[model samples]
Target: MSFTVAIVGRPNVGKSTLFNRLVGKKLALVDDTPGVTRDRRPGDAKLVDLRFRIIDTAGLEEAGPDTLEGRMRAQTEAAIDEADLSLFVVDAKTGLTPLDKTLGEMLRRRGKPVVLVANKSEARGSDSGFYDAYTLGLGEPVPISAEHGQGMIDLRDAIVEALGPEKAFDEDEDDEAETDVDVSAGSFAGEGDSDEDFEPAYDDTKPLRVAIVGRPNAGKSTLINRFLGEDRLLTGPEAGITRDSISVEWDWRGRTIKMFDTAGMRRKARVQEKLEKLSVADALRAIRFAETVVIVFDATIPFEKQDLQIVDLVLREGRAAVLAFNKWDLVEDPQAFLTDLREKTERLLPQARGIRAVPISGQTGYGLDKLMQNIIDTDMVWNKRISTARLNRWLESSQIQHPPPAVSGRRIRLKYMTQVKARPPAFMISCTRSDALPESYVRYLINGLRADFQMPGVPIRIHFKSAENPYEHKRKKR
Candidate 1:
């Protein structure tokens, strides 16, 4: 029984700060720049005993439909529609402006429950703004400092009251029950169980961690907002507005997914600013931790050198990847563009030869289903493991077809092979004079293993081990 609360306000009013506080994590990019948030980002938040979904939205602005601010406004409106309540934040230091008044009237017209918040109340001069909030006609405003954790008790009481006392009690009871069950399960496990037989209880229903990464302004945030059906992240004409990796949990077609909206990655040489370097490091961290990465590209200028580099990094990191061509609606000839793109992908990214490339319009919500499906499929491949017997059979067949080249007039004798691990599929091969194996022969075996095992677009690792000779012990004694 999760309810949603949308935090709406003009730019730089501490909406993201409050969101991070409620969620107990810094999951949104908080900056002093006005209108930094463009998408509506959602997170599971708890205020004291009250639990609900919280959304951080773009700032409200007065602009026409054709303008970027107008589009941001539309996204905020959509969030308000989806939310059960709206936390209308105002700058207590600056008092109520015309924009706040306008937003108050807009929320009033919607006739939904709104909790008017006077943020930055910790400052000495905030009393005036706090008093001014009473004039909004949406009931008394709760004055609190979102940055310093002030006035949270009042805010929590307001939320509990708005949601009704009965619902609050029910949530408490559910939490207690869940805690009791967890304790009971822990006590049930015995210490005598063998490591192989003692399977740790884990929920297979946990959310899949997916990271969206690409060059700056590649529509990564837009794609996530579309999936959520709200303006959940800050998007605008400005590039690099998102400075942190923001993660939001979502359910898609009954599958739980934890989506990471990361800052756009730029080449190291061009990243001169300290902030930009930190942002790139954060994005790299997200990519390394992610189970699957969707590398986004602007369709108008798809597959720049940087984009290819990003894809190569994903492969090198051994993470599953899917290529996404965004803003497909603007493409004039879709079929031709896709054909050319596919050819280029195969030629440039041979490591991930059969990687799925989806053409999508994040704004229009086209091809999203295919993109998600591809992610699931790629994850499956990434976790694939082959049996040892099957691997040895494949190895034998491969050696018969193209035998390892002779080294210094002596034939290199290949022995058996076995799969050492999964999750990118690592293998080990024992052979006589393993150092004599040519790089070309190693590649031949790798290609053969990939083809035989149907492992496309996932990195495979092979390690060569020298088989110990039985006569070596006698020679050592001599």
Candidate 2:
């Protein structure tokens, strides 16, 4: 396992900025607002010859255990406990505050190796704050500008020294071996490149990207924490406690999965706050980037208009989805509720008919295995591809069973069909007078395809392309 490093500091100390710099990606949200990060997030980071698991944690604060700030501090402490080292960041421009001293004392009590990081040291007058950080007794502070990528070499040397010589040597050896594996895995260049060459690298070894999204106060964070078997994410009775979409790596049944716990999304009219708007946008981005999305719903209030809208959005985005009903333990009548929910799922969301709906309790861990199995099943179906011959055969039988409607005394002829892509399977069909095809006729073909292919609960796209005539181009040339 890679060595772990946790970036811990008080609010607005540029910890997230340094995390982004090390990970070489903008995975964490950075803002001027204090206490923006409520959960600790992990990322694979590389610094020169060093490699480790970098954790960006919520700012440390003192509050009652039941309060929100207290919960945030709990998450930060959890990260520090799991990490091999702590990067105690302090804002050089602002100088050391009382809270910084308290945090320093707390880290010293924990007896963990910590590298004092003096952030925002780019200004000329920030040297005084850098000198002040020495009083914390954590060793000489490494003055670096996290945003501007200055003084990284000194930080790298400090980390290597803290990790000790033996560990650093082993890591270098691992990196050398990993470099060979990456080169072999990425060697796809050839003279004639095809779709096979451009296909995304998806295998059992790679983590399955799953995004959990739902309405506010729907227990999204609770469900994720249950899956993780820890209080890895902050959870509370308050609505919208989760403001940023945070991703966590998990191992489920020996399969790697990257689970994303997103902010509870509300309707546009209800989302008036700018922070909420940013949170919703981040959630949408997670959905777009995810391979599968689990739309959680409160069992008592399932199938609301907003819930249906979110499902439709997922379908439009061409993502595999499974409907998860949380808080099932609270239900008084499970039999009747399940029956009604299945009926409504089929009736109301006919666009994605036969979608899998699993009743689970995020708080009690009821039916979680079934939910995960169904999600895996849905992902498999979403990635399924039908052969061209099989597609044409199905098309022939479907057309013979129920031919296209006649338009202007001429029937629309669908001559050929082929699948264009998978991952929410899309197809293209060559047809005569494509524009004359009615929406009902298109729906008929879609339903036929779904039934024949056994593709349930996954979105399918069909595009009609007009058949080209050879004589038309000749006449145009003349």
Candidate 3:
């Protein structure tokens, strides 16, 4: 097994910077603001020959149990408890605050192994603070600049010393632990690539990437905690409590899933702050990379403008989506509320016709099984492929049922159709005057394909192309 280490410290001590440095990616959002990170974000870290799982935790703080800060502190404590080792970061330039000493005492009480990190040691006056870190009684301080890439060798040595040989990684093993699969790569099959290249043969051995996105306080994180059966993420009554698009690996019915909990996306006009913008961007990125997206909606106020906008964005990105009506326990009339929600969804989201909307309560774990089943079902539909001959047959009957409208006083004839790809199920249609074919006709064909092939909810793309002229090609040469 690989080693696991958690970075812990007071706010703005460069713990996240250190995490980004160790992981060699800007996976976590960093800024000068204190308490920017609230949840525990994990990443795979490799330091030359040594590799381990590293978790970046929220800064330790003293707050009431019910407050947001208190919950963030609780998350940090949990990470410390679960990790094999803890890297206690202290700002060498600013010296140590009273909170830092209190945190040091707390770590000491935990009885877990810890290495004191004196960050910003590259600064001219940081030597005094580096010397002062020894007073925390966590042993010698490893002074390094996480931003400037300074003293990483010393940091690696300190980690090895803290973990000891038994816990340290073996130098001979060439293979590293498998990280999350980027299922979003090559989403579109390019030219010279066959249709088989985009086929989605799900390898059950790999984790399915699912991203949960919704407005703030919509219980995106709560639903995940329910699935985990633990309070792994920080939650409170406050809006916009989650800032990062945090991802966690989970198992459902023996199937592995890497679920991402994204920040609540408000309307674009309200997103003026730089931090919130970054959080929203991260959430959007998650949507693009996910194999399936769950768009959670608040039962109390369902189908807000922003909610519809989010759904549209998911469909446009060509990701399979399942609508989750979270907080179902709050609704008084379950049947009536669900009926209204379904109607609204059908009206607002024509792009995703026949979409599945599961009523679930993140707080009480209601209807979670149904939601999981729908996710699995939607994924299957997203990967559905129709045979070329069957596609052409369907195209013939569909055109016969509703003939294409006359464009510029001439009939537009659709000659043939075939599926070019599966993940999102894109198809190409050869037709006369393809450009003249109206969008209404395209919608008609798309709706027909969805109903005929049992591919509901997943986005279906149909590209129209004029049929090649064999006689024109021969005569042009003559």
Off by over 4 Å in 2: 172-206, 473-478
lDDT-based ranking, best first? 3, 2, 1
- Superposed Cα deviation of residue 241, candidate 1 (Å): 7.6
Model 3 pairs in collision? none
Q: After superposition, how far is residue 417 of candidate 2 from its true place, in Å?
A: 1.5
RMSD of each: 6.2, 4.0, 2.9
Task: Name the runs in model 3 displaced over 4 angstroms.
Answer: 170-176, 180-206, 468-478
Model 3 lDDT tens row, 323-396: 99999999999998888888998988988999999999999999999998899999888877676678888888
Worst 10 residues of 2 by lDDT: 176-185
Cα distance off (Å), candidate 2, residue 112:
1.3
Quote the lDDT for 46 in model 2. Answer: 84
lDDT of 2: 0.87
Model 1, 1-478: lDDT tens digits are: 3577999999999999999898887667676767667767777787887777788888899999767788778878999999988999999899999989999999999988889999999998989999999999988899899999999999988877776777544543354211101112222223223232233332335457899999999899889989998656767777886776777768978887878898898887899876677678878888877878999999999879999999999989988899999999999999999999999999988877788899998999999999998898887777665656677777788878888888899988778776655556677899989988898888888788778777788888899999788899999999
Model 1: residues with Cα > 4 Å off, grouped in runs: 167-212, 216-264, 271-286, 298-301, 324-343, 358-376, 399-416, 430-441, 463-478
Arrange candidates by TM-score, descending. Answer: 3, 2, 1
